[model samples]
Target: MNRLPYATVARCVSSLSRTGLYQGVDLRVLEAFDLDALAHFSGMQPGALCAGACVASQSSPALALTSANLRWCPACMAEGLHAALFQFSPITRCPTHNAPLIQACPHCGKTIPYRLDPAAVATPLACPTCMSPLVADLTILAHAHHIVGP
Candidate 1:
């Protein structure tokens, strides 16, 4: 959506507000998506995307819910995908060490450590160690229920 009209963005904000989600998100937050800024704003590394953020615009109707430019945060998405995955919004610290974690290749199964400055977003995810489907495409319908099942 190239420069979505103010009305559209407002509608989305209104909807989110009514749902009691993203109540404090400033309108400027949605404005960042104008130039594929979700990648940068989300602080996600290149290539890899967490499951929740993994669902692309073409993958599911869930994205239709946000003005997020169809870009999802893997960490946030993981939480939505599976409650046990992670516990943080805009996760700035490494869930493991409480330090910082970077995106890695799930295929290579290597931890591509990152600093997560919390001040910077849009980090690349190519592993200097190996290749992996970092952002493995998945449909929301497939994961609409439970990633690990009760």
Candidate 2:
């Protein structure tokens, strides 16, 4: 994806330099993947994701359907995979594996922002603060999900 277009980045997600967090691509990006079909593959209930888990716009609803933090499943990360379903606030645990959604590095308790930057893509499975290995399997599919600077 070296020739990845700038328009796509401008449309999908935004890397926040000031806050060091990110506004991930629209949850609608997964719409084409069909939440129901994805849940079927993930061994979860389709309705769990049908609650209109839209990110908060003006904060009218006290409980936003989704969260900004990248809560992860230990089971999936152990296999070097990330499930987008973990982004929903309704998903407290991985239904398939029954593992809790983790928001911080267990070893250091440092919260990893749900960022979409090069460092995160470059070291996809390592805790930035403590350099802890988050992925036990470390597959190629887990590395550099984004284009990096030379």
Candidate 3:
């Protein structure tokens, strides 16, 4: 991945500096993919995929939805894929596999961090605390659905 230019960093810093609320904000936060910013920076029009934030923002009296730390579908991980929906707190199960999404390492019982260091051996597919591969357990899936009602 190409590092962001100094000018981009300076611009972001300058903007944040004016706000005075977020002092010492890490520059790495800027590298996180933002659909709106990406569209503006690339000079390409954002499409339907860009509506995620809007959809997430809409309120409903019946459903109390909130964003959570990164969670993963182990089956998806085994297939080398990550679904964006798993990051939502209200989504407790993987739609594709009918398996429960895991937020913490089964071994270490620590919540997964939002971002993983690229240089670290601990990947999104593995537990940062125990370095154990995150995989789906069918037994747990059976128990989960029985309690939660699938």
- Candidate 2 C-alpha lDDT tens digits along 1-150: 112222333333332342332333343233322444445444456565444343333343633565666678887776555665687678899988998889888889987765444455545567878878787655433244433343
lDDT head-to-head 2 vs 3, winner: 2
Worst 10 residues of 1 by lDDT: 114-123
lDDT (Cα, tens digit) per residue for candidate 3, span 1-150: 112232332333323443342223321233224545545553445563343221322243322343435577877766455665676578899999999988887788887664323312324355767777664542343343354455
The superposed Cα distance between candidate 3 and the true structure at residue 31, in angstroms, equals 8.8
Segments in model 3 whose C-alpha atoms lie over 4 Å from true places: 1-64, 116-124, 135-150
Could you list the CA RMSD of all candidates, in the order they appear? 15.8, 8.9, 12.1
Q: Which regions of candidate 1 fall more than 4 Å away from where they truly are?
A: 1-104, 116-123, 137-150
* Candidate 2 or 1, higher TM-score: 2
Evaluated with TM-score, which candidate comes out highest?
2
Query: After superposition, which runs of candidate 2 have C-alpha atoms over 4 Å from their true positions?
Result: 1-63, 140-150
TM-score of each: 0.20, 0.52, 0.48
TM-score of 3: 0.48
Per-residue error for 132 in candidate 2, Å, reads 1.0
Clashes of each: 6, 0, 0
lDDT of 1 at 93: 52
Per-residue error for 13 in candidate 1, Å, reads 28
Candidate 1 per-residue lDDT, tens place, 1-150, comes to 112223333343322334343333322122222223433443444333333232333345443343321222455333332221222234445454454433345456555432111111222223335644234543332354345354
Q: Report lDDT per candidate.
A: 0.33, 0.55, 0.49
